[model samples]
Target: MNRTQFLRLCALGAALAVGGPAALAQTYPSKPIRLVVPWPAGGGADAVGRAVAEALRVQLGQSVVVDNIAGAGGNIGTQQFIRQPADGYTLLLATSSTNSANPYLYKRTGFDPVKDFTPVASLAVIPSVMIVAAGAPYKSPADIVQAAKATPGKLSYGSGGVGNSAHLAGELFKSIAGIDVIHVPYKGSSPALTDVMGGQLDYMLDTGAYGQLKGGKVRAVAVASATRHPLLPGVPTFEELGIKGMQMNAWYGLAAPAGTPAAIVERLNGAVQAAFQAGDLGKRLTDVGAELRPGTAASFAAFWNAELQRYAGLVKLTGATLD
Candidate 1:
């Protein structure tokens, strides 16, 4: 009603206009977010990504949508994320194929897993199960080694892709066993498992995506880890199967484009950690043959670096080329 009161009101309005948006942005996730899964729907990556997205949606109080943009061994969807705004609203579901192995696999990957993406937190690690067709002569990993020894270049195995984690796992198996098994590269694990099931291929050492044992199409002979998974309790580990230094597993993590605000990254990480705390999320992961693993951004960075180093060594050892 007075001039002074009007001036004070104007000043208060200016301050609110400047500071209101800043406070709201600090809250983050004011709306639904998009999570890109770099694999086709119905695949392990998609399944896991959706599960995590659902959990994050509930934890963050914002809808998390999963978009499958599969291609080029997961680089297509991943590249899309690199080009997206680094504001935590857009996320990429990271897998071993895209993050750790793909960089070394390609002559030039569009995005650097370590530098281009900021890891929120690791979701889980799924152990690879070495499965053979039911009718295959190799009843165990030793049997496969014996076959490889007897027929070096003749004995062959299939993998999802040339430089995929499964292919590298098979190569590691060969290196440790002192055997030479030809790798038959397929587009994805589904097809590789298809051929292996139809007896078109001898065996496949892949991440546990096929669910072969339950279908009775293939027999899981060994797991590519130090200890056998509870889901594959009957199957022997590589070491127990007479192969040493051949442990391998695939992991999943949540990441955003680099340069995302630190607060936003922390908020996303907190949501992921909250999802991990919720019991059903762990059970869901376990049902999908993954063990829940949650860690801070620093821990994820260290893990990513270690993985990169390990895969690089394997790439050199195998002389495997993707280009």
Candidate 2:
């Protein structure tokens, strides 16, 4: 062919290449979408993932299924999710532990939280409350701090496991309160909370303690947030109690494998934002103690990056390590 014909053919090829991703993004969710929760079925992450999946199913007119892949402090599921195709079909219901804390906690997490995933949208932030048994002697956060100070290493706190958010929060609290509280790691929160109620432990931090507090099983001494949680309005914040550097929030967000089409990521983010704006998902999450945080992909990425740095510093300061 002549030079003019060759140039025209090259231009056509370029147009097809440029339009291919946009075309694919427009028809995204033509099949079912997998929402992977890197935790057990009954945990906070699983609940959030299921709720978001259902809302997305309704909003996107496609089936969004939640797949629980639990192990290795959420590293196993996260690794598995990151290995999937970057087609926007498989999504990870990422948490602070998986995306922020795990890398610093474990020596070999096998995935880079910042680089291995594409941020879709931030779903919510769940702040932990420092809880003690309802009948315990500690009536407030100050009481706990004073007791720990009076009897260093006598007051023990329970957590889901080493290097988990609860553990980190407890460490931060100890550091800020200038007390010596022993850390007791459990396989999961239920057992830890159970021990706390049984008086086997002095205190514990949890995001899902509202029901327990209402049922008179546990009492919240303080919330590890800047402000009081709506569910536990009577509970004071650590900062309010004059304890600085103890504010921590466990957040959840949606992410796809790295290199996913930006158009697809934006579409998913829009769906999540729409779901939150519709009020049902927001109410459901809030009822479970999650603070709604709907935002764009870019915003979520910035937030995620900031969280990584924050958790890294916390981990280093706390000297928390899983391996």
Cα RMSD of all models vs. native, in order, equals 5.0, 5.8
Question: Which regions in candidate 1 have their CA more than 4 angstroms from the true location?
Answer: 1-26
Q: Model 2: per-residue lDDT, tens digit, 1-323?
A: 99998997787567658788675566777789999888777666777888999989988999998998877878888989989999888999989987899888888888987789998999999999999998999988889888998898898998776667788888888877778889988655667888999999999988766668889999888888888998888888988887887787789999999999888998899898889889888988987799989888999999999999988888989777663
Query: lDDT of each structure?
Result: 0.81, 0.85
Alpha-carbon shift of residue 286 in model 2 (angstroms): 0.8
Note the residue pairs that clash in candidate 2.
none
With candidate 2 superimposed using the best TM-score fit, by how many Å does residue 287's alpha carbon deviate from the native? 0.8
TM-score per candidate: 0.88, 0.89
Poorest 10 consecutive residues by lDDT, candidate 1: 18-27
